[model samples]
Target: MKKKTTIYDIAAKLGLTAATVSRALNNNTKISFNTRKLVLETALEMNYEQNKLALALKSGKSYNVGVIVPRIDSNFFSSVIRGIEEELYPKGYHVIICQTHNQENIENEKINSLVNVQVDGILMSISNANLEANKGLNKLLKNKKTPLVFFDRKKDIKGISSVTIDDFKGGYDATKHLLDQGCKRIAHLSNDRNFEIFRNRYLGYRQALLDNGIEFDESLVIETQSNVQDGRRAARLLLDMEAPPDAIFSSSDFAALGAIQEIKESGFNIPEDMCVVGFSNEPFTRFMELTTISTVDQFPLDMGRKAAQVFLEEVGHTEDVKTTQNIVLTPELIVRRSSSKK
Candidate 1:
């Protein structure tokens, strides 16, 4: 391999001080634009790789932000990650992403690892296990004061900020939409009840039924794992009941898709026999023509952007953490063929 070029080599070639080259590489505002451009060109020509770790150590500013997500395979969270990258990359920030696989131990370990890396800040969407009453992640994050921001799956930790959608309202709107379509005996296909967003959704569903003078039927509610298989199983169980639900409001689009599959397999016509509404307006929802009421465009992208903005503001001291902010964006309900009944 060719000898790797260093900043000193670039500085020597340009007859400028190494400090000027360093400042230019970092896009330091103090350096003149022309000089910065010239130094950057020289560094590139010499194949000089910028040493981020050395720069971080010298300034005590990593220019790196860590994000912990449950999983990246989901459309919702992935979009949020994209949003975060869009907001931070332009401002000279790098993101390190880690997944917890929804395990408490894994989540704890990831957070600790990020903290050890001296990251400037962390943005997290904790797992279901972390939300359990026995989990100690809330205490751990709070005690560290590590400039943590929670999005989507957040717990109420003092001094930490969060950006999320109004999950309760999303639940209410989904249930209400089904009811408006003449669904009296409707059931919910729920995810892990420990997650605050899911719990809030359940509450909203119950409240909407109560407001509409519909009896809250415990037998009609089916709890399932956060996936399509569980949704399919729950649909089968509900369909086998003596008085099957006329409609279903699922907390996840994956679950709703499963429910639709099972319903169709059972020879029940959709909308005419059973209507389905799903959350998280995922791309597949529109493609498949499923009627769903969803919250947040995708928590990952929006949350990521908002979380980075928060870190930027906090670092600049333009925004104070003393006044903790909980920003909840509104959800939209998309009417489609699946839930419509003439």
Candidate 2:
């Protein structure tokens, strides 16, 4: 195996002390510009690499941040990760991503693993399951004094900061749009009600109905996963009702796609017979051209960037003086062909 070159090797090659080489590498103002330049050149020529772990141990900073998401394949999470990387990479920080698949146990384990590795900070979106029950995981992160930032999905933890959008307003906009399109009975395809995001969306839907003087029908609401199959099943159940809904406000684009497929199969002309709207504005929503599904533009990339900025700010402060922040980005409603009647 080839031997890895170190700062000591570079120092010997340049006839300088290892401390001098290190200071040069770190861009210490104490080192002369000419000496720093020469040390850098020698280090490059000798293929010398600085030990990050050793440096972290000395400075009490790993320069590594952990990001936890429910799933990476989704467009929202992927875009958020990209935004985070764009912001943190320039600041000499490495991001470690972990997916929990919306499982609380997996989320707990990932938090523990990241904490055990002594990561400088953690950014996460809580899963659909109740996070308050996972007190142990929260305690572990708190004990380690690691900065925690939640993006999109969050919990009401005292010390943690969060970056999210107004989901209630998003839901209200979607439902109100459907009502304007002459949708008298609107069905809702919901996810787990345990999380505040989904619950707020459901509340928005209900409030929109009430504000419009439309009687809220409990039968029109169906619980579903954020997938096509569950969406199809939910739609079928709604269709089987004696008075089926004239529109559907789904919490997921994937579910909306499934509902669209089932609706078409049942001989319903979209926008004429039934209108639909979905959340998140997933990529597939545009490709299908199913309906002008009014969706919430969560500004995932911005969310990620803001989350990284929060981490940077918190990490710079002393543990005792750290302050929590809750940044809420405005969600824009993108009206499309699926939900537009006029």
Candidate 3:
């Protein structure tokens, strides 16, 4: 393999001291714009790659942000990431993204790794709510070297800022809408047992039924992995019951779409034999004409940008107040052919 380029090599070629080269590379205010430009050009010509770890050790400002999400392919998380980038990029921050695949161990490991790397801050949506270690998490908050922010999928931890939607309200509204459509018997497709968000959703569903004078049937509630196949399987089991559900509320669009496929295959009609409502409002949800109530619109981007902004503020580049803010955006319920009884 070719030798990796270093700042010393660039300094040598440009006839400048290593310290000058480093400061120029870091955009120090003392360096004139022209000198900085020259150093940057020479560094690029020599294929120089700055040692980020060493620089972080010296400056205390990494200019690097870490973002963790349950999964990246989903529309909700990705949008939040995009929002994060939009807010941070202009301020000369770079983001490192890690996906946990909904595993607590993996998520913990990733957070540790980011901490070790000396990232200025972290904006994370946890993989599994059950994986939160208060000791470990509190250490991060108290470190004073790095700040942490949570968005979506956040644990109910005090002193940590989080940006999330009212998941309970979303769930209640989705269920209430189906109930309003005269869905006498309703079922819910829930996610894993470890996720608090899904648990809250299930709670909302039960509460809506109780408020509407509908009996809460434990038999109608199904829990599965947050994926299409699990959704399809859950739908099959529900459909096979002696008395099938009149409506189904899924916490995930992926599962809702999967259930829809299975329902159609089982010779059931949409909105007639069974009404389907999904969450997340993913792109496919609209294309497939599935009724959905999704929270956190392009929220990944907003989450990412806001997280980055927090880091910047923490480091004193900006006077953004360090408030333990809990921002909850309302979710919109989109009605479509799937849920309309008319």
Task: Give the candidate number with the greatest lDDT.
Answer: 2
Steric clash pairs (candidate 1): 79-301, 80-300, 80-301, 81-300, 84-304
| Ordered list by TM-score, greatest first | 2, 1, 3
Higher-lDDT candidate of 1 and 2: 2
Better of 2 and 3 by lDDT: 2
lDDT of each: 0.81, 0.87, 0.78
Question: How far does residue 63 in candidate 3 sit from its true spot (Å)?
Answer: 0.3
Please, what is the TM-score per model?
0.85, 0.86, 0.78
lDDT of 3 by residue, 126-162 (tens): 7655533534455576675677788877777766777
lDDT of model 3 at residue 324? Answer: 73
Q: Residue 331 CA error for candidate 3 (Å)?
A: 0.8
Q: Could you say which candidate leads in TM-score?
A: 2
The superposed Cα distance between candidate 3 and the true structure at residue 11, in angstroms, equals 21
Assess candidate 2 and give its TM-score to the true structure. Answer: 0.86
Clashing pairs in 2: 291-337, 291-338, 292-336, 292-337, 292-338, 292-339
**Segments in model 3 whose C-alpha atoms lie over 4 Å from true places:** 1-59, 131-144, 289-300, 317-321
lDDT of 3 at 336: 76
